[model samples]
Target: MILDALFFLIQAGLTLFFWAILIAAILSLLTGFGILDTRNRFVWALSDFFYRVTEPAMRPVRNRLPNFGNVDLSPLVVMLLVQACMLLVGAIRGYMIRGGLYF
Candidate 1:
């Protein structure tokens, strides 16, 4: 019972975090090309928020990846990593829920 509840919480938390990272990625793409002007206060604030939220996850990846001049691929890498982590957690929970090794 407790394990079930814990699994649910983990699933939900990972899902929400995945979405947050996705949104930040989209906002970054748009802002990078100036499709969304940051001159306005609201836009600036929103962009800043996304930056603050995603920068930590992205910076390390960015540093490790080979630079492509103007292109940024850290967001894509981070998104893939987040998805992999979510899948790994879900699979582990599923295995435990089904009594894997005990069987």
Candidate 2:
């Protein structure tokens, strides 16, 4: 029961983080294309929030990657890594549910 709850919690956290990254990526593209102007107060606030939420996870990835002038691939890399983590968590939960270690 507790293991199931833990898995649920892990899944919830991953889902939230996944949405955050997706939003940040879309925001970056919109702002890049001038569709979302940051000068508006509300837009600015939301943009700042997204940056703060994503930067902690993204900055390290960005630092390790080569600087690509006028382009950033860190978000894509982060998304892929997050997906990998989700798979890992699901695999662990599956293993636990499948009778655990028997022997």
Candidate 3:
């Protein structure tokens, strides 16, 4: 029972993390394209927060990747990695359930 609950909690966390990364990626693109202006303080703060949170993981990837004539692909790569992590977490949860490792 306890193990099952723990697995559920982890899955929930991973889902939230995945969604956050997706949102951050979208926001970054919108800001870059000037489609989503941060005139409001709230928008500014949200964009700033997301950039800070995701930049560390993205910086290394950006440095290694070649820019395609003003197009930045770092956010896409980061989103892919985030999705991969979510898939891995789901697979582990499924394996635990199928193997009867959790009660």
Candidate 4:
């Protein structure tokens, strides 16, 4: 029971982080293209929130990846990595269920 609950929580967190990274990427693009004005308090706040939430996860990926000029691929890499982790957790949970190992 405890293991199942732990897995659920992990999956939920990964999913939330995945969406956050996606949103942050979109917001960044909009701001870069001038479609969204950072001068607007709401826009700025939202952007800042996403940046704070996503930056820690993205920083390592960013550091390892070679820069592509203005294009940032760290979010894409982070999303993929997070999805991979979610898959791994799900697989482990499924295995535990099938093997009756969740005691």
lDDT assessment of candidate 2: 0.87
Write model 1 residue lDDT over 1-103, tens digit each, in one string: 6667777788787677777778887887888888999898998898898788778888999999998998888878887888898899888876875875322
TM-score of each predicted structure versus truth = 0.84, 0.90, 0.73, 0.93
Give per-residue CA lDDT, model 4, range 1-103, as digits (tens).
Answer: 7896898799899899999999999999999999999999999999999999999999999999997999999998999999999999989888988998977
Clashes of each: 0, 0, 1, 0
lDDT winner: 4
**Mind giving the per-residue lDDT tens digits that candidate 3 earns over 62-86?**
9999878777788778778877877
Off by over 4 Å in 2: 101-103
- lDDT agreement with native, every candidate: 0.82, 0.87, 0.79, 0.94
Error of 1 at 27 (Å): 1.6
lDDT, candidate 2, at 48: 89
Worst 10 residues of 3 by lDDT: 13-22
Model 4 reaches what TM-score against the true structure?
A: 0.93
The positional error of residue 34 in candidate 1, measured at the CA in angstroms, is 2.1
Query: Model 2 Cα displacement at 63 (Å)?
Result: 0.8
lDDT of 3: 0.79
Query: Could you give the C-alpha RMSD of every candidate to the true structure, in order shown?
Result: 2.5, 2.4, 2.3, 1.2
Report clash pairs, candidate 4: none
The candidate scoring highest on TM-score is 4
